[model samples]
Each structure stands twice: as structure tokens, then as C-alpha cells.
Target: MNETLAHEDLPDGLGLRLKVDVTRPLTDLTAAVNALCDQVAERRATTVVVLELAATPVDFREWPGDVGIQAVNRWERAIRRLEKQAAVTVAVARGTCGGPALDLLLAADFRIGAPGLQLILPVNDGHFWPGMTLYRLVQHLGVARARRIVLWGADLTLDKAAELGLVDQVSEDLEEALHTAAVLTGRISDRETAVRRQLLLEAVSSEYEDALGVHLAACDRELRRLRRTRDASPQNLVGQAAS
Candidate 1:
């Protein structure tokens, strides 16, 4: 049976939590990822939380056959599925992070890192390993910067990563960051938020003219609703105040 450490090790109130300690055996890592993905899919949680590299980095070379491939596939599928559902994922990082840690970060919508956070893009003896990491890096950073990171295996400090827009924030405190994220997401209605998110996604690969009409109509609808709600306020109080 696959055993997971108790959740008490991390801070509380995360909808669904996934913690990966690379110091654990490869078997345990794969089990944790699979279990986490299943829980996320089942709950359809609005947020997916990750605690990354809390221990020594596990050497991918030590993983047995099929474990590495399955682990990567599980994470890839979970991230894409969650993205389509208007769910946001956050990666909280500390210490030396590369390989699978970097890959998971790319899969997240937001990344929070500590002072020592360093990013290592995948490369084997000067040859870049072309995988989902490369694909996502290119999508976010464009071809030139992506190539530089991958080919040369550049290490990015937390401040440097923030400058490059790789991470949302770099702070010593993880609890505060989590609370901020919760507050930001809590104010918005889920359905409306999902609609807006889908529209933005469509706009990315869509032509301006084609998206303009739909975008305008959605905005106008919301505006009209707000105006009506505002105007429908009680007039008796206003008149009493005037008298």
C-alpha cells in the first residue's frame, strides 16, 4: 500500500494539497502525484496547491522504468484539465529546483518562491531535452529566451525570475501568499469568473474582429445589470435626507 505523510506538515485551508518531497523513494513520489490528481479531479476544486521540493532533490536517474513516464503524464493531464475548468494552480518553491520541479512550475498559473529559488532549465551535457517543459517555456517566454534557458541551462534567481515574469512573487512567507490568493479568488463569482477566463483564452488564438463583438456583448450585459441594481435603490431615504 502507498502511504502519504499527514497533511499537518503544511499550512492549512488549501482546497486540495499536493506535496512532493524529492528525498522520498520514486515509488512514493509517483503514488503521491496520482493520488493528488484523482482528488483534484474528483473535487473539481477551484484551486490546486503544490508544495514543491521540501526535501533533497530526487535524481530522475534513480527512478525505475515506467515510473518516470507515468509521473510526467499524470501531472501533464492534471494541469491541462484544471486549466480548462477555470481552476488556478500555484507552485510554492524553495531551495534547488530543476527537472520535474521546473516542469511542475511551468504547469502552474502562479509560482511563489523563497529567496533561494533557482530555476534550472533541462539540459543534458549541453543538449536541450525537448519536452513539455520546453514547449511551455517557449509559450510563456518566447523562442529566444526559452532557447537561452534550455540550451545553456541558465539558473534564474528569484529576483531575476520575477523580472522575467516567470514567477508571480518572491517572498519569505508562504502563508501570506496563500492568504492573498484566497482573498483575490474569493471575491469573484465562480461561474462569471469561468466565463471571463474562457473568453480570454479564446482571445489568445482568436482574431481581434472575431472576438470583439462577443467581448463587447458580455461586458455590456454585466454593465447593464450593475446599473439596474444601482438605480433600483430606495428613493424614500434620499427624499427624507433632503427634507
Candidate 2:
């Protein structure tokens, strides 16, 4: 079951590699989601790359009874948890990415795609699956573009995805995308990254006055740390000794 999702520790524990096969069965996908949740819970200063393999669009209607429905719900929850918990989550799309793959991509903080990347959404019996994925698309791409993709059943090319801000980078080279992700991950400490992420999330629903306190608290922490560092510097120590 773990084989369905391979986990690799990046050099120097900078992040993790989560290779997922979206074509796998619901049970396998569930296992993969569980594994990802475990990794996120660690709250390390690590970047997570969700590398997707080839997969056809999944149709939830085809799943057997309530079990399939439950799996879909659980999978979505897992992605949401990852989005909120991981210090930095990046999704890399190569080849076809649809259904579960797209869901994971939307949940990531950043996305990188290959030149041949194609994003698809599954339509069940002529009706699109109305899910949280639609809300995510709207948030990232706005209502007009989200409608075009969700209602019109339009496929997204890598270039268009980047143009719409859905993807941060578009490259034919997989290694280039990975390098970019790693660099982005190293730009901040784990604690600061998490705090900033929370600030952004709160800003979406919080007024300026309401958000000021939290921001100021974060500022105070930064200021105090800086002061401490200055006090402990060699120059400060030497001055104190001379005095």
C-alpha cells in the first residue's frame, strides 16, 4: 500500500518527495493521503513536492456504494490538512493531471508544471462534479476563468495555467522545477513560514483592524529575537567586558 506513494527525504531534511500515482484505486489513494498527513504533522521546516504520475480523470459516480463516497471525502480532507499544515507545499505536474491530481495541486501553496502538462476535470453524466475544488479554482483564477474551466470543460495547458496564476512556473525540465521549489522552501525559517502563512489565510477573511494584533505579535517576536542576537554579538560582549 505504501508502494503506491513513495516518500523520499530531501538532502539535509529540507523537505520531502511525495510521489503519487493518481491512477491508483481509492484505497491506495487513501493510504497515500494518510502518509502525507503524517509527514505534515511533523511541522518541520521542509518543502513538500507532490509529484504526480500519469492518471486519467476519476469519476466518483463509478465508485462502489458509499465506500467510494467516503474515500473521496477523506481524501479531500487530507489535502486540506496538508495545505494548512505543511510549511511549504509544491505540486509538480507532468503529463496528464486530472481528478485527484488536480485536487492536490489546488491545495498546494505553489505549483510547477511541465510543458506537456494537461489539467482535466471529470464530468459525470454531463454534469461537472461540484466540489471544493471549484472554490479553490475560483480563489486562484477568479470567477470568470473558473467558470470557463468548470462549466465549459476546458482543459488547461501549462502556459495558460501559469498565465492564470494557477501554476508558479512552467518548464519542460523536471529538475528545474524541483530546484525552484527547493529554493523557495529555503527562503524562510519554519516558524516564520508558518506564521506568515497563517497571516495570509487570516487576511482573506479578517479586516485590517482585526488582523493588526496578530501581525503585531509576530512583529514583536521578530524584534525581540533580533535584539537578543545583537546583545549576544561579539562586539556587545567586548564592550561589556571593557566597561
Candidate 3:
């Protein structure tokens, strides 16, 4: 995974650029994802992962469920870490998405879907493949809210995805949507983006009383950081003695 990424560099400040094509083997896709995480951490910037899903059924080189559990676990963990990394993650979904594709989209900080985007969790042997994708759906839209999607699997049209808040933007011009997402990512500290993302993820299940202390601590940390920034300013430190 440490090998140099074959995609675009950090020249324009949009961190690593990577592609997720389900037609490829799971190993290849997972390796690419892990590499993206590493590069984003090093650059401390935003990353946009473009998902390439076939509009029709894919004859997967390697079925996601056919892979060993360890591999699946590793990929899922990478996505989880990616979600909490200091770098912002933006996902672009163009066609129908499901399985690993849907998992990646859910993990992203910002998701952009094409106007005709549809989401599904592929069924194998008459049962929906049980993966962390289901867990993520539950996390995003609690168990009750995600009943149909979890119980069996439901196709989510672009409009439905937007209504469910799964996608941040839908556009005919995916490139422009990505540009808009990149601009939005710049409005916040890369580190703070991860912090706030973690807070939001936890906010879903955490009770107010239990979450209060954690929220207060985050506020205090921010205040302390602000003070440190102020004290380190050139104007404020002009007369300070070298210690």
C-alpha cells in the first residue's frame, strides 16, 4: 500500500485522487483505499475518491462476499479510520452503487451523487450480504429508520438518497459537484473537520447527559487552542522574552 499512488498528486490542494472500481479484485480496491488514507494523513488535505460502478450488474472479478473475513475486516477498518483521519474525505458516486461501493460512500465526509445515482446492497444466495455497509446505514439512519434497507435491501433512487441525507449533492455535472465539495472542505480546519465528524458520529447514539462531558471537553480544547494561537501571533509575542 505504501507504493506511490498512480493518480493525481496534491498540486491543487485536493489531496490524493483514487478510484474504486468494483470490477477489480477486492484486494486491489482495499489496497488503494489504504494508500489513500496514508497519503491524506501525510499531506493533511482533502481526498476525493471517485467510485466507478457499472450501471448494470457487474461480473465482479472477485465477489465481495467470496473474500475472506479478515480481508473484509481490514477494508472496513481502513474506511473507519479514513472517516476519522485529519484529512477530509469526499466521495463521488456516478452510477448504481452497492456493497463495498455503498460502504465507501457512507464513510465519506461529503458524498456527491450523479442525478441518476441509485444505491443497493447486493443479495447473495437470496440474502443480503452482511457487511459493515449495513452497520453504517444503521449508524446514519438508525435501525428503525433503516428498516427496509436492513431487513432485506431496498434500492435507493437518487431522490431517495437525498431525502435520507445520504448524499450531500446531486448533479448532472459530477465534476462541478466535486469542485463544490472541495471548496466546502476548505472552509474548516482539516483537523477540526475530523474532530467534528467524530462528534457527529457519536452524537447519533449517545444520550445528551452522557455526551455532555465529551462535548464540553472538545469546547475546552478549542478554547485552549485559540488562546495558544493568539499568544503565538507576532503582534502579541513582540515583547515576549525568549524562554
Stretches of candidate 1 exceeding 4 Å from the true structure: 5-14, 23-34, 41-55, 60-75, 124-126, 188-206, 209-243
What tens digits encode model 3's per-residue C-alpha lDDT throughout 1-243? Answer: 323323455336655566565656667777877776766667644444443333446732233757788887888787787777776677888777876777778988778888788887656666776767777888888888787776756788999899999998888887777776776675663676677888888998899999999889889989999999999998778858543
Question: Could you give candidate 2's per-residue lDDT for residues 196-240 as a string of tens digits?
Answer: 887876676689999999999999999998999999999999999
TM-score of each candidate structure, all chains considered together: 0.69, 0.82, 0.84
Model 3: weakest 10-residue lDDT segment is: 1-10
The residue ranges of model 2 lying beyond 4 angstroms of the native Cα positions read 43-50, 53-68, 240-242
For candidate 3, the lDDT comes to 0.72
Two-way TM-score contest, 1 vs 3, winner: 3
Pick by lDDT: 1 or 3, better one: 3
